[model samples]
Target: MKKDVILELAQRLRQAGISGEVVDPEAADGLSDLDEAYAVEGATRSLALGAGERLIGYKIGLTSQPARDAFDAKEPAVGHLLAGRQLEEGRPVPVAGLFQPKVEVEIAFILGEALPGPHVTAEDVRRATVAIAPAFEIVGSRWRGGARSLPMLVADNTNAAWISVGARTEALPRDMGSTAATLSVGERTIAGSGTAVMGDPAEAVAWLAGHLLRSGSRLEAGDVVMSGTLCPPTDIKAGDHLVAEVGGLGRIVLDVV
Candidate 1:
């Protein structure tokens, strides 16, 4: 894709995020591949940074094989997380500011050491972690009718939105892949295990480390990485109170308004 076209799409995405209005899917038509998509994502991130939004960390998307297969992707996609988009625990999330938001439960890893990887492994991720927490990722899309293609989705920052994190603990699970989690919204409850995320959330983090390294970036010591959702995303509405409990980890509470 042309540099000018990438910047133009980035501007469209930025405007859509600010106005809470969906952008035309055609706006990303110029994106030809994942590389181009990431170019647009970087451009979009630059625009946000210029506007005073701080990059806090990164989020991994499509960590499950099913999700990867659906998108014809061989690996997970990455997105930047901004500090301004973090939702406070126990605070009401304003629905009016979001566009078609949905929630997913995830295991979050707070790094204690930088993982500058070309050969990082899941065990490396575990050894470098300082804490783990149950988390709620409120994903929203700024593209009309959602993203029409994988590249389009990537260009839109993998549907990044609000992230509300729960309490953290330094004690790591004996078997992260076996760790379980349950998400509840009122009387409805959905269950999933860490195995759902690339068989192990730590492995997802490992992949993230390599992914970042390829872009000349690395997982910093203080960075928080959302290892991807354990279960399918559930639609959320105003007045919805959601709770997620991770086995051996704490619980997360999010109220939508």
Candidate 2:
């Protein structure tokens, strides 16, 4: 992709983000290739930084079977997470700042040490992780269409907006794959487990580390990595209070305003 086109897409995304308007980025040419899509993502990150958003971490998406099924993808997609988009525990997120927001329950890792990987394992992620938290990933799309393809989603930061994190815990579970999760909004509920995310949440981090290695990058200390969602994302509305409880990891609450 040309640098000009990349910058153009970044401006489009930035405008869409602020106005809560959806755009069809595919309408722009040369975003079909995987590498080109990632280039566009990088340009968007640069644009966000220029607007004063801090780079905090990364997120893995489509690792859940349901998400993969929804996007017709065989593997996970990765995207940038900005510090400005991170929410404090129990805070209300203004719905007006987002476009078609939805929420998903997840387990997030705060790395204690840098991890550079081509062959990183789950145990590697476990050793590097200093703390864990129950999290809610607030997802939205700049894309105008209802459903999306991998390349299109990749170029749009995998539909990420804000990540609502609960309190951190040092007592990491022994078997994360077996960790249970329950997401509740008012009376409606959805249940899943860590295993729904690539067998183990650590494995998802490991996968991300290895994937980043392909681009000559690494996961650094203090980086917060969000593993994939435990279940399909739930559409949120104003005045909704959503709670996600991860067994042994405590709970996170997100209030949509």
Candidate 3:
């Protein structure tokens, strides 16, 4: 895609209130894997980067095999988180701008200080964290039926969507990295787990911080990176009452319509 084309397409995505799906001329060359996906994510996020909005943090998903298999894809993808997506806990997730939406329960981080890039350890994240908040990532897909190609999803912002975070917790849990839990939609329980995310949530954040640093970026203070998912993402419909109770992090709830 030409520079103008890419930019225009991106605008359409933004204005449409949903990530845009593009058909790359050389689809295979556009993106080969998850790593490349983030590369494109950086390029696209640049559209919002340095625009006066501060980086909050990062979030991860697809920590479970079933979650990965749910997409029938390998590796996992990341997104450039923005403060705009941070929805208050118990608020209804706005659905007007999403397509083929879904939800994933995740542990969110509140950084205490700016994370220096080039290399950040799990300890760095722990030390910088002000609190560990529970959150629900509203995931949407570029394609119907939950399947997408590598490049397809990359240009689609890895299906980036709204993120609803629970109240902040100051007393971080001991085994926050591997705390098991359950996701509930009102009385309808959906999925549950903890260690499913990269075996450790802290490590996931560390890895992402370093990964961005290597690409000439740094994890900004107050940035909320959504690490990979703790359980398989469950599809959701409007009017559904969503609840996620990660044993160690308490629980968070949201509804959509």
Candidate maximizing lDDT: 1
lDDT for each residue of candidate 3 in 1-257, tens digit (9 for 90 to 100): 44555565455444444334433334334345555455455555666665544446555555556656766657555566777767765568866545678788888887778787667777787888888878888877544333356555655576777888787888876666558878887567766555777677877788777766766777776777787777677778888888788876778888888
Q: What order do you get sorting by TM-score, best first?
A: 1, 2, 3
Off-target runs (Cα >4 Å) in candidate 2 are 97-99
Clashes of 2: 0
Model 1 local distance difference test score: 0.90
Q: Estimate each model's TM-score.
A: 0.97, 0.95, 0.82
Worst 10 residues of 2 by lDDT: 24-33
lDDT of 2 by residue, 210-241 (tens): 98989878999999999988867888989998
Query: Every model's Cα RMSD, please?
Result: 1.1, 1.5, 3.5
Candidate 1, 145-253: lDDT as tens digits: 8887899889999999889888999999867999988999988899988998989999999999999999889999999999999978888999899999889997889
Task: Give me the candidate number with maximum TM-score.
Answer: 1
lDDT of 3: 0.68
TM-score of 1: 0.97
